[model samples]
Every structure is written in structure tokens, then in C-alpha cells.
Target: MRINADFTQRVAVHFDQTEWVASPAAGVERKMLDRIGDEVARATTIVRFAPGSAFAAHTHDGGEEYLVLDGVFQDETGDFPVGSYVRNPPTSSHTPSASQGATILVKLHQFAPNDRTTVRRSINGADYVPLFKDDHETVEMRSWPSGQVVPIDAHGGAEVFVIDGGFTEQGEEFARWDWLRLPPGTRTELRAGPDGARVWMKSGHLSGMV
Candidate 1:
């Protein structure tokens, strides 16, 4: 099934307002953001694992990327706590689970054919750095001070995910976990709220997806 599968248009998902759908595994559920194809698909989602829940071992043929939103997520390699960002490149495999429970933001099958770099970081421990950059694509994380107005010119499309606090865009307030995807050539105006905000932003990834 397809949901928000069109890349040519803009999309925004306030996860707090979405309902969770159970996954194939017991005690695991997901709030789908964008999806294409069937069970095996290119997708973005917010996933949750109830205590003692686990998923069978699986290979990421097209790569997988995720950030732990709360609690802890674990696999054969190690445990990832809240704020951990990880990227398992194409062909990687793992069996994921949660002992105490966890919530994560994840993307599947969205890597470029030749992109094979693997990364694991903690948003709280790592200094803000450029995550990815090229003439056509860029990704980064930044902090916005309270009352600051930040304007963005997305020449080849843009996406933003709030990591902390809240921000307003076109008068709509977006708190942690809110995600926004905009089409190419769009300009966005964002203003930080009283507590300020921290966000992960990406641009130019939609250049050809549209």
C-alpha cells in the first residue's frame, strides 16, 4: 500500500496525532509517515516496541537509518539509548528488540545505490556536525534560540524533524517528533518557541524523487 508516496508534493506529519498500527511482530507497532510498495517498501516511520518485544533477524538490502526517540533499542551489536542516531548501510543485517521498551524514528530503503557509509552517534554526545553534503544534497543539525526566526530556501526540497522543544511554521506549532517535508523550490519560515528548539534538517534529497 502507498501512503504519502508522492514525492512531488509537500507533507507534514504530527506524530502525536497519528494512530499506531501493529507490525508483523507482536507488541511492535508503527506510525507510518511515507510509504511506497508493500511490506518490503521504501518508508519513513515512527516505531514503538513494547517491553520484552523483539523483531526477527533481517537484512537491510537497501539500507536503514534511525534515531532512538525514547527508552532503549538493542541489536546484536549493542544497545542504543534515546538520542542515538544510527545508519546501517546496504546489505547490513540485525535482529532488533527492546527490553524496557523504545520509540524510534526510522527510514528504510532510501539509500543511494553506491552509498555505503555506516554511522552511529549520540545527539547529546556528538558535537553538531555536517552529516552529509554534496552539490545536490545536504543534511545537518542545529539549535535555534528562542524567539529567533529562521528562514529556509529549499531549492531541491527540504525536510525537518524536531529533536527538542518546539517551533512554529506558518503559525502552526511543532514540538518534538513533528516532521515536515517540503517540495523543491519552497521557502519555509520558522520561529523558535519559548524553550528554543533543536532540529535535524535535510535538503536536496527530493530533487529527483519528485
Candidate 2:
């Protein structure tokens, strides 16, 4: 139940190389990247929903954040197509389903307990988009041009998920769906690959919990 739970270490994962493990819901499977507990746990994952698949209504006691990677995602709130970024803050509840199948990168039980902000948006075609920012964390989507070098300061840890193309950081290459987590105080530069790169990033949330 503890997968890459160490906050002080740097970790990287190639999304496509991971095994798909079935979730409690039928037709819904997940590739877990990090976890700290059991079924109801603090986790980060890439989930896929087969056509017509659905999950029962559930409340996010510690909040939920996700991005639609492919296909369409649906819930009582509305339908979200690929490139959609959503945040269902603490105490929100919803029954999610995918009528025509979908894939998403999701984070569960990782919000400040008192946070209640809700956000839903599409980042398709966006060169730079700031999704959310609070005292605890900052989330954003950014695109890098080919061969461009961008500096990053992980003041309180940082995570990057490659959406399209590729990039290299400290000699490590990251392609589509690849994920990288840098520990607090790390300062680095990411150089875009030949085709450039678009990525989703989160930072400042890992300040002191470790």
C-alpha cells in the first residue's frame, strides 16, 4: 500500500510501462504511482474507464484532482473531454462514469482538509495555464518549445506529468505520460526534446509533511 511514499526521494515513472490493476469498480483499472494507505488512501494514479463503465457515488473527504488524458469522462456535474483539468475539493461528492471510455491522471486524499475550492477547465491548445493556487500548493500547465531550457525551483517539492512530446531533466528523459517527482529544495532545468513538450505540474504541497 506504500508505493513511492517517501517524500524525501526523487522518483520517475513511465506511464505506459506500468501494469494495470483493477479497481473496486468494474471495468475501471488503475496504474498507481504513489500510495500511502489502503483502499481509501492518499494516492496518485492513472486510471482507465472502459466503455459504459461507472463508479458509485462517493465523497472526497480529502479532495480529488484529475486530468482527462483521452476520451470522455462524465459525472453528475457534466461531461469532460480530453485535456480537462478538474478539482473536486474536500467534501464534494459525485458518481463518475465514462459512456464511451476514458483515461485520467488522478490524485486522491491529498488536499488541505479545510480546502473547498472547485475548478474545471480544458487546457487543450493552451501554452500556459494556471489552474489553481492556494497557500498550500500551485498547479499549472505549461508548454515548452523545441530545445528550450526551462528552470524549475522546487521550493517544497514538485511533480511533472508529461502530456505531449518529451523533455530531459538532469540527463533523465521524460516522454508522453511520463511522471517525475522532485524533492523539496531541488533546483533544476528541463530541456525540451525535438518535438517540444507540454506538461502539467504541481508544487509547494510537499513542504513539511515528510
- Using lDDT as the measure, the top candidate is 2
- For residues 1-210, write the lDDT of model 1, one tens digit per residue: 899988888788997899999999999999998999777999989999999999999999988989889999999999999988888989999999999999998989988767778888777854375676756567677788899999989889988898888899888888988998888888989999899988888788788887
lDDT of 1 at 87: 83
Query: How many clashes show up in model 1?
Result: 0
Candidate 1 positional error at 179, Å = 0.9
Off by over 4 Å in 2: none
Residue 76 lDDT (model 2):
92
lDDT of each structure? 0.87, 0.95
> lDDT score, residue 62, model 1?
85
Off by over 4 Å in 1: 125-127, 134-136
Q: What is the lDDT of residue 150 in candidate 1?
A: 90
Over 1-210, each residue of candidate 2 has an lDDT whose tens digit, in order, gives 899999999999998688999999999999998998988999999999999999999999999999999999999999999999999999999999999999999999999999989999989877999999999999999999999999999989999999999999989899999999999998999999999999999999988757
**Model 1 weakest lDDT span, ten residues long:** 125-134
